[model samples]
Target chain A: MRPVVPYVTAALLFGLGVYGVLRRRNAVLVLMAVELMLNAVNLILVTADTTARAVLPHSGQVFALFVIVLAAAEIGVGLAIVLQLYRLRSTVAVDDVALTEPPVSAQPVGRDVEAGR
Target chain B: MTGADLLLLALGAVAVGAGVLVVSTKHLVRAGLYLVVCLGALAGDYLVLGAELVAWVQVLIYVGAVVVLLLFAVMLTRAPIGASDDLDRPGWPAALIGGGAGLGLSVLLVDAYRWSTVTMPGAGTAERLGEQIFRSWVLPFEVLSVLLLSALVGAVVLSRPDIGQPAPQRGDTAGDTSTPQTVGADGVRR
Candidate 1:
């Protein structure tokens, strides 16, 4: 098999991931884009395993496995964070999620942070 | 081109196409579904490249766990189910950057390979991969396990907001909060 096919594929995938990450507003969608980039990297590593000479056998695949593990952990924790964000802020848009605390007047809904206290 | 090359090319096309749909589609759930298609096609590419174990692992972890987790987050966030126009920022910038990156990399890779054929490697059977992992890669493997443990604990802690915060206002299945103007804001509006 010509190795360039997979290499170019990985490249385009990574590019798409970059677009998704930058374009998507939702945090979950951003995470999905991040997954795309990770997958593209994994594809490159696995392709390199077959094409490039390496000292350790299956090293590319091993790194791919590690990448997979990392991705799994990432998604789990990422979802937790997203869900939590939804809980507190009631939205998951990357832009809408302000880094600094909003003024008390800007609180969207009547949460009554003081309710029942 | 051999059958394997053709298969790889076809699967690559599927992956790239679905990836486009994943980022472009307006339907919130459909994007997740498109991701499944894209990832599955990549798995096929892996099989064609002789990484048998990696292919299956891709299917198992990426297709199974990660996509599921994404869908759950989508639903949990109450993301708009059908099409909403404003899921993305202005298209030109993303398109320009993504296109530049993809085309440049493609040009470089194509130039490097330049129609050179490669001998396919031995199939990465589970047994051989396991041996390599346990023998030479044992330390990283153990460390990865620790990372996974910490991630799990951290996810649990992060999800359960009551852990650190002084007041526990609501549960994980967040409801009762009327989320106004959440559509253009780009997420769920409860």
Candidate 2:
């Protein structure tokens, strides 16, 4: 039971994150899932850090700190982009705003056209 | 199980539950709020793991800054605050893919390191962490800072309002008291 608690928590968090990314349609939720995944990784790092405090040094915690900062910046910019999409589409559902190809227009010409063209 | 183990189980349950709610709930704002809960639980887990500095930073950066920014964006975008019944896409494939990947990774990880505790040094403190970040990781840290600065500049450039006319504030009782309308697709009020 030494590291069991942290291990279970990390696994659960990772699983939930997967579920979020899979099932959530809102782009915001997707971003949140990504954050959850990152935090799960952090938990593992901290657990390992605790176990190896005497040998491997503080690199684990330091790496986790860097990750936190990176996650902040990523969320800030990501939400801004999502906000932009919402303003244009009036909805945040990820599938609603996809544009595969631009519409094109051209003159129509056909052999079965009316009269002589 | 010890007290620490019980605490870990509790935090894990909360985090997983909140994460499920975050995705399954129809209200987007609630989802963002749930993320706060999930991250908080994660911070608690970090504390239990003895990474106190990392734990606090998790609270500060994720719960304090990231989620707040997300909420602000949700508010500014005027995303529906209530349950939305819109079914966007066929999500089963993505779910299957993600779930499969997670399962595979979990199995691999468990198989590779099953309850094998290998404790290294400086796991709980920040002294060596500071040294590492300043020494070996200095270049990457500086690069990350520059990247953040550029992102900030880009956000301003892309989303700044370009409204042609100025309007009275909502608090001005002499005029219409309606809140300012967000202007464009880019979060600019124009």
Candidate 3:
């Protein structure tokens, strides 16, 4: 098979992912874009496993699996952060996730929303 | 063209088309669903390339778990089910950069390996891949396990707001365990 098809596909996928990340304001959407980029890289790795002659066979596939694992972990933590952001700020827009101090009106809430127990 | 070439081309088109929709769709839930389609089509591409293990892993992890988590997050954040005009920013710069990077990479790769046929490797089943991972790539695998563990801990901590907060004011939550009066209040809260 001609490998260029998958290669170009991966490139365009990564590019689309980049556009999503840059243009989207929703944090979840940005993470989804990042997933697109990661999947593109995984495609490249698996395709390279078929095309290249490495010292260790199937290394590309192995690495692709590892990348999948890494991405799972990333999504888990990323959504957690987004949830916490929503709890504090009431919005999941990426524009408002500043590292500065909390807003003035946010100081008086007494309850921990998640620590219900 | 060979059957494999045609299959790759077809699956690649599906994957990219779905990917565009994933990022560009107006409906938030539809974007997540479109991500499922895009990733599943990429899994198909992997199958066409003979990477069976990677394809299944992609389906299980990316399509199954990650998309579900994203949808849950969307709902949790109370994002509108219909459409939100504020989801996107100005796009021309993003388009310029994304298109430039993609085109540059595609041109480089195509020029490097234009019409050359790919030499198919050995069948990358779970058995052979496991051996390669355990025998040669053991250290990285172990480190990845540790990383997963840390991510678990970090996510738990980040999700809970009461984990390590100092008592800024005694009146903030008089429901301290030391006081029995607020016990009824805390009980009512729970």
Top model number, DockQ: 3
TM-score, model 2, chain B versus true chain B:
0.76
Error of 2 at A89 (Å): 3.0
Ranking by DockQ: 3, 1, 2
lDDT of 2: 0.69
Query: B4-63 in candidate 1: lDDT tens per residue?
Result: 989999999999999999888889899999999999999999888888899999999999
Give the DockQ-based CAPRI class for model 3: medium
lDDT string, candidate 3, A70-100, tens digits = 9999999999989987888789998887778
**TM-score for chain B of each model, two decimals:** 0.85, 0.76, 0.90
lDDT per model, in order? 0.85, 0.69, 0.87
Please identify model 2 stretches exceeding 4 Å from their true place: A51-56, A101-117, B117-123, B161-190
DockQ of each: 0.65, 0.27, 0.80
The full ranking of all candidates by lDDT, starting with the best, is: 3, 1, 2
Lowest summed lDDT over 10 consecutive residues: which window, candidate 3 chain B? Answer: B166-175
